[model samples]
Target: MWKIYLLAAISFLNGTSEYVIAGILDKIAEANHISVSSAGQLITVFSVAFGAGTPFLIAMFARMDRKKLLVYALTVFSVINILIAIITGYEMLMSARIISALSAGVMQVTVLTLAAVLAAPGKQGGAIATVIMGQSSALVAGVPIGRVVASHYDWNVIFIGIGAVGLLFSVLTLFAIPKTVAEKPVPLREQFKFFMRPRIAAYLLITFLWLGAYSVVFTYISPYFLDIFGMSNHGVTTALFIFGIASAIGAQLGGFSTDKWGAFRTLTGGMLLHAIALLLFPFIGQFAFLFYVLLIFWALAAWSSGSPIQFQLISLAPAAASIVLSLHSALGQLGMAGGAGIGGIAVKNGLLNYLPWIGAFTLAIAVGVTVLDKVYLNEKQFKETQSTLFIK
Candidate 1:
């Protein structure tokens, strides 16, 4: 359990490094003598690298000892961040971000896989949730903390801090995590075939749509708050804080619910609630209390399904757990990117009020997909059982 918590801490460090750049973009741009839009490309490159590169890395290194790989990845991740802290040129910063993204992607998949394999029976979901909580807590605290550090010192200082902590945790992970049996190296061609199965394919679709629904609204939430509710900067910040806290709590609750209620029920219930929460955003009008309550509930509902979704994917193909998880993680990044892209289109069309509705509609489609997949699976299992009984 303590080992799981330590993994979570490393996740927190990794997540902060991933997200804090968004908060300090202005500072970074000024330091590098680039426009802020160009500065934002650092984030785009990181996401693209993480989403497109991690699965290959995991497959390529499949035969390496899990413990050693994790340690090496963390060491590389730390060293990259430290290098970023000392670098001044835009091109150098972009190059460093790519390396950091790949390392962070590897770290995330390895951490989650380790948690799932190391947990006691029936506790895998809980353990995974604990690791996710680390990421969620970084969202809650990392950006604001980055802002504070940037206000007083250099923005690059945040990376240095993340690098220092990462190194410390690399040592901790080396000492604490026991070595596990290495996965047999799967050919890249064979690994891509995992996506061909119908159920697995459907599950991946749900992963994309579910996170896409959340990101569609969340990516543009500050502007939505300003345009729709006329929230001052302070007010928007306060709302974001609440949303972040709810998301963290929702992640922990998701694990508990998945363990207790089974993955299907938890997933179905969470998605339904998420859709309902978003669908009501426009109808809720100008009631502040109701708005805030709904905001928290929306965050809770949006996040609570993460553990169950991952649990289902792992259950689908335990033999290829790392491959599936890496793919799932990659798809999740794509989903967020897709959502943000779509939301940008809406905002460009002057459709800010409709963001929630678009998100809700996307979630509704995901819910339908989940339900249909469940029915198909149930019928298939029943037929298989009947055939066995008949033969007997």
Candidate 2:
């Protein structure tokens, strides 16, 4: 249990590295004398590297001892952050972001797998959820903290602190985690087979679209608040704090709702709420009280879908749980990348106010995909169809 908590702490660090950039997008842009839209590309490239590079990297190192791999990845992640603290060149920063993303992805996946392997029987799900909480906890605490710190001192200080903590956690991981035997590696081809199934592919697609819609608005939220509502730094921090808390609550609700209502029901309803919230954002900016309510609502609705999405994926193909999970992570990040990139394009074209509408449109497509899967491509439906054909 202590070990699981420690792994969660490590995940919190990795998540901070990935997410804190959004909190300080304007600061980084001002420092480099670039447009905020250009700064947003930092997010796009990091997501691309993480989404495109991680699964293969995991597959490449599949047979390595999880304990050792975790420690190594954490060390590399720490060293990269430390370097970023000192390096200021734009190209250099981009290169560092790529390295950081890959290391963070590997560290997260290894920790998740290790958490399950180390937990007692029947407790694996709780253990994995604990680790996920660590990541979600980052949004609640880490981003607001970064925003406050960057307002007070150099933005680089946040990364320096993360690097120091990461190194310390790596040492803790080395001493605390027990040695475990490696399982046989699943081939890339074998994993690809599960993806070929209609239901499996549609679930993954929904993850991409759902998260992509989230990223479209959220990737530029800092500037959006500052520019439109004229929020002070303190106000921005407060809003983000509220948003983060809502996100954490939403994740818990997602898992609960999945258990209570089943995955499809929970997912479709959550996603509908998510899209509606975004679509309403453009119209609510003038009312301060309503504005904040909508922000919290948006965060809650967006994150509430996460657990059910994963639940649906795993339920669809239980034998390939790990593979499906890895694919889910990859697609989720790619969705974020696509969203951020599209938002950047819109921002560059002077369409900042239109971002929420664009995000709503993307989520609308995702909702449709979910409905399509439930009606036409679900496994139960396919099985029934096969039986009917055989009877004829």
lDDT, candidate 2, equals: 0.90
Highest TM-score among the candidates is held by which one? 2
For model 2, residues 228-273, the per-residue Cα lDDT tens digits are 7888888888988999999998988988999999888888898889
lDDT of 1 by residue, 202-277 (tens): 8888988998888777766655676688766567657767887888889879989999999889999999999999
TM-score for each predicted model, relative to the true structure: 0.79, 0.96
lDDT of residue 163 for candidate 1: 88
Q: After superposition, which runs of candidate 1 have C-alpha atoms over 4 Å from their true positions?
A: 1-4, 21-44, 65-68, 82-95, 112-129, 147-155, 171-181, 226-236, 256-262, 282-287, 318-323, 347-353, 376-392
Most accurate candidate by lDDT: 2
> Compared to the true structure, candidate 2 yields what TM-score?
0.96
What's model 1's overall lDDT?
0.83
Looking at model 1, residue 205 earns an lDDT score of 88
Candidate 2 clash pair list: none
